[model samples]
Target: MERPNNVPLPGVSAARAAERATSLAAHLDARHRGQNAQALIRAAVKDLFRGRIALVSSFGADSAVLLHLVAQVDPTTPVIFVDTGQLFEETLQYRDQLVALLGLTDVRSVGPKTDRLARLDPENFLWQSNPDLCCRIRKVEPLAEAIGDFPAWISGRKRFQNAFRAELPVFEGDGARIKVNPLAEWTGKDVEAYRLEHGLPEHPLVKFGYLSIGCAPCTDRVKPGEDPRAGRWRGRAKTECGIHIAGSMTPENEGSGI
Candidate 1:
């Protein structure tokens, strides 16, 4: 029997993937090493990938700093926001407010296809029984489809947020696309100081201890002394939604906010 047609296949071979990753990693190390986040984003938005790139943001607790920097670099840079249909209403409103406040002109809101959701999660309780599947259906598939046209995309993950991201690089390639992590070297204090310096508005739930807000069903409040991302998928070992996972790689701990 032939393979199912609806499934997505890996686009690059193992040999090609390793070669591309090595080449890109070397280039990024030389050019972006020790560079600040704003400069890195500027290069990604205007110099390197330019029109072929988009910034992926959750507009969660740690979002304002990155969004503000991107706006300053180019408000017209494509900003892709994924709405899982399970997000808090406050997140939707916050997205609106930030778009206007930052003068971001090209923000695109994408989500799961209706038919897929109806077929797979009609009851809307998939997270209770299967959170990984729920994340893939809601987040991974949608984000993958949303950015398929781009050669490079930006992510907002930071090293300080979790153990899985401790050694993240400024540029990562899985042979298919270049993933930029401008804030890989940033710490919690750096983010907070920048947020306060720019007077960026915090997500409403941040005050309620929801440090890393995502779809309301899978997110929870972080207790004091926990990592900022501790509130996300509290009971599960799964951290990523598969959007950031390369072929055969362990799932990335994308944190609650990314």
Candidate 2:
């Protein structure tokens, strides 16, 4: 009884695939602690380097760790920084310094489309009523469009930084591309150690307790032991501004002129 190669065997069911995905996710999450972070990222780089892989950086308080790693692997790899027209002056300056010191090449600054920004909110006043919309316009939408051609992108997200990121994996599938978090399992201390060891520069705001730096208007400084992202969109019932996700936005939430 010869069996066809492509078809499943007599009793193979869809459940097996679901189980495999779950198992694989769990295994990677569990195994991604400490030294495994670099090992897995190196492996991923090798596997994914057949095409373009951009490192999405904010040059924020904690991004130096991953940026240093990326520089070590391939300085020529594209590093995409979204300059949302509202970042701290220090942040922008830090970005330039780090890029120069790390010898990073292809560091492109992606921003909102010019005409859309003019049509949506000519004065950039949309941050008042619809912060989410402002974010989509200035950050998410532009970034999604910019990265449309790449199959995978690198990020500096760590699990300990936010509740929504508690279960972050080294690799996850975005709607259009894969998101690789090489530092997913790292903690604040780990980042500090890497920075110090490699002589990487930190964002100037970090010393002033701005743990999670985003747009200037939506972000603020935090006290010790507070959630790093506590000050972002402060007094508003928002955790993330949806800049990282693709197409999960609505006109009401992401386009309303608030």
Maximum-TM-score candidate: 1
Output the number of the lDDT-best candidate. Answer: 1
lDDT of 1 by residue, 80-190 (tens): 999999999999999999999999999989898888789889999988888877887788767777776576788999998888888888988744567888998999899
Tens-digit lDDT string for candidate 2 (1-258): 121111113464434432443454444445544546566666546553334578888899998888888777778878888899988999999998998888997898988878878987798888887787788788887676666556567888889887878977776645434567788888888889988988888789988889999999999889777788988888988888685553342222333333
Model 2 residue runs over 4 Å out of place are 1-35, 246-258
lDDT of 1 at 27: 79
Q: What Cα-based lDDT does every candidate model obtain?
A: 0.80, 0.72
| Runs of candidate 1 exceeding 4 Å displacement | 1-18, 248-258
